[model samples]
Target: MTPKIVIFDWDGTLIDSVDHIADSLHLAATELGFPALERDAYKDIIGLGIIEALQTLYPGLAMDEIQAIREGYGRYFFSKQTTPQNVFAGISELLAELAGANAQLAVATGKSRRGLARALESSGLGAHFAVTRCADETRSKPDPAMLMEIVEHFGIEPGEAVMIGDTIYDMDMAQRIGMPAIGVEWGVHPRARLEEFAPAAVASDMAALRQALYLA
Candidate 1:
């Protein structure tokens, strides 16, 4: 059955911003005199909240160090250019198709409120979403808090909603709350990794994703 509400993850799933994000994190860490890991290392933490990502990347970080890295990351991230072109090809059409089918669209992202706002504005995709929840506003992914809130906001049961994302965090959160999840291969995590979370389906591209959502 087609879900009434479809919640999307912002960075890797909707837009092609993973490389840019990884770059920003590397620059930030390097600026702070911390050794930056490979791009894949940063990519692994893409769906987590900033603080959580930082903690995971550099465990045992002092509070002050975390704050410093956060500031540095923000500076580098915003300094880069972003446009509607960054949105994955066919995403706009896919979103429109979902809305046309009477499915409510929303965003559940690891980005901060300000960061998401900027991306939404720049991408011109904000109008497509019925609502959005940022990492800073609630418990991060794999926790189910954000997804639960989105479900409540729409006055629907967890089973009536579906989450679409590129990371295992998205899958784990949905699974924890009895919501179906669809994973995209184009995102940070590999198909095998996402499969471990038992997603309803793992899509390799937009066409496959649409089919997973019953839109095809």
Candidate 2:
């Protein structure tokens, strides 16, 4: 863990929220008269914000219609759903180990701040992250806003920080910002899809992830 500063993506990397996200998204899409997204569609459109994901799902939709869909989705996501979340297996142990090693941890996610905060508090993982960059706090992934903001917050060089996530968007963000990326196979995206982004390394699980970081 020589880098010390590690930023993680939340949804598929640390917590398993795919089923919930898919269900919610399906509901929203149906209400908007759009086709339901399959698992592969979900995997493809993830890492972007809800609006962006909806745009990807329905490319020909008008701006006003898209806004309406976004509003409907947000209402459903906040009021009717509980995020359908569960921490991944071995994540708690891994976080504990990272903390014990005196490494600096943070979160840079596309989730809204309130949503991310509630999820973290509910999962008992809030204390593990020193800083969190949410959708409201920065531009979305591929922009490097979250990564650069977190690096500045930690007073560390971007090269000394590692971005851990399951999507190519995370790898692209890290690369754009001059940080190494650790792609995880356990996430929503396929390993081959992630490799398309040319990540610094790929980890099959938390234990292997630790070893990769150790070598770095």
Candidate 3:
């Protein structure tokens, strides 16, 4: 059966913002005199919330220092560019097609509320999602709370909704909630890692993702 509601992850899934995220983290670590995260380790944390990211990387930092790091990362990310950057090709078309097909699109992201809002506004994607839940607002990805909230808000059962994202966090969360998920190549985690979560499809590209979601 076709899904009535579709949940999407931001950052590497829909936009090519992994560089920005890694860069910002490096900047924050340098500014705070903490060790910078390695590229692979950094990529692994892409779908996690900022606080959680910091905690995992620097597990013993003081609370104030963690907050400072968070602030510093935000400064680096937004200051370097005039606006959000690096949306993947065909993303707008995919969302538009999904919308045209009467899909109720929602966003379940690891981005904080402020970060999600900034990206949505800068990317001009706010109108596409009928509802959004961020990690800051609920449990982070892999926990299923965010997905359940979106489904509950829309009054749809888990079976009627599907998640389209590019990370294990997204896939695991959907699985825990008994929702089907479609994985895409345009994300931080490797395709093999994403496949370990058993998504409905590990789409090789945006066009394939569109076909899987709209045609399959």
Off by over 4 Å in 1: none
Stretches of model 3 off by over 4 angstroms after superposition: 80-85
1-216 per-residue lDDT for model 3 (tens digits)? 347998999888888888778888888888778886688777778888888888888888888998999889888888854243466878888888888888899999999898888888888778899999999999887889999999999998998999988888999988887899999887787789888888888899876887788654
TM-score of predicted structure 1:
0.98
Lowest summed lDDT window (length 10), candidate 1: 79-88
**Candidate 1 C-alpha lDDT tens digits along 1-216:** 568999999999999999999999999999889986978899999999999999999999999999999999999999975798998999999999999999999999999999999999999899999999999999988899999999999999999999999999999999999999999999899999999989999999999999999988
Clashing pairs in 3: none
Candidate no. 2 TM-score: 0.90
Model 1 lDDT, full chain set: 0.94
Which residue pairs show backbone clashes in model 2?
Answer: none
Name the top lDDT candidate: 1
Candidate 2 ranges with C-alpha deviation above 4 Å: 78-85
Q: What are the lDDT figures for the candidates, one per model?
A: 0.94, 0.80, 0.85
Candidate 1 at 67: error in angstroms?
Answer: 0.7
Q: Cα miss at 191, model 2 (Å)?
A: 1.2
lDDT of 3 at 185: 83
For each candidate in turn, the TM-score is 0.98, 0.90, 0.94
| Cα displacement (Å) at residue 208, model 2 | 1.0
